[model samples]
Target: MLVHHLYSGGKDSSLAAWVLTRLGYEVELVTVTFGLLDNWRFARETAKRLGFKHRVLKLPVEVLESAVETAIRDGHPNNAIQFIHEKALEALASMPDVVRVSDGTRRDDRVPFLDLPKARSLEDRFNVAYIRPLLGLGYKTIRELTERLFIVEIRESEELQKADYEVELRHLLRERGIDPLEIFPKRHYQSRVLGWKSL
Candidate 1:
């Protein structure tokens, strides 16, 4: 199946991209730029280094209000970040060969969303399955993978350190014991397990 890996330019997403490519899947790396403001140069650079086709989509923060509302109604503390992925996936649905949208979700993230009522098989949603190559690993494991793979220069800009409103909100949620990052997708569903690392 044609797959597109969601590239966040972070250690987790980069490691997931590497895993997908090495497994012999025809995977493309896609990053959704928030407000056209943050140009994920890291994701782009990683895609270049790994030689994977990279795609980007710009999303307005306001465009995600409905998603935010839904998430909030569901008591999701990191509603904004979930809204970001909702917008990102919506944008991806418009593209071609999007049979699967791969993510960097790990074991912990599999809990909430995977068990939520909204959790449908990927094929049921985007005509694509959402794959998570690093679902078996944790943040530490992802970091170890990056070191082992010799991943270089994948840090975000200082501007993003304090500028990403969603990430900041996620931090707040983290403090409240929500841990928003845990809701990110994963690759632990019923499927032929395959390793897709490229570098």
Candidate 2:
């Protein structure tokens, strides 16, 4: 079966895609860009390095902005992130020849996660399966597996600004004279993968 893996060029997503590939699935990497400002260079480069077909899907800034606004209004980003992920899945499911959708979400992932109800709903709507290979793995396990499978260069989230979907939304909020920190929790650390060691 063909799997469209939601890739962010992070360790988790990269590992997830690698796992699917090992499982004998035809895997294609898909990265969602919120606006024109944040070019997904890292994601594209990682896909190239891994020898995977990659596609960049441009999502309207307004759509993500609306979700960010709602999350800020609600005082938590989980809902907003989940909304964006679901929307991404919907977009991928609509693509021709896509039989399955997958992501790098792990057992500990709070945001960008699909609850059972939502997963069931998506499967019913699209007649496709949603897979998360790392769902049962913890951070330590994922990190170990990543180190074993590929040599990766990791950068702090802030340093890799605009590499993540939330970064664009944060920038939008900041441009509008709002403080993203007020909405997002303090000391939230995310990472980006620069490149992987050649096998």
Which whole-number lDDT from 0 to 100 does residue 92 have in model 1? 75
List the pairs of residues colliding in candidate 2: none
lDDT per residue (tens digit) for residues 1-199 in model 1: 5677766655666677768878878878777655434545555765676667877766664554444445445665355555566556656764675667777667776322243333353446666666768777876876666766643442233223322224434444455576454532222111111122455
Q: What RMSD value applies to candidate 2? A: 1.8
- Regions more than 4 Å wrong, model 1: 64-77, 94-96, 110-117, 152-199
Give per-residue CA lDDT, model 2, range 1-199, as digits (tens). Answer: 8899988887889899989988999999998987656557678887888888998888877778788778778887778888888888998887778889999999998888888998999888998899999999999999888887776665444556324577776777778788887877777666566556555
Q: Which lDDT value does model 2 have at 35? A: 62
What is the TM-score of each predicted model, taking all chains together? 0.64, 0.91
Give the poorly placed runs of model 2, Cα more than 4 Å off: none
Return the TM-score for candidate 1, rounded to 2 decimals: 0.64
Top candidate (TM-score) = 2
Per-structure clash totals for the candidates: 10, 0
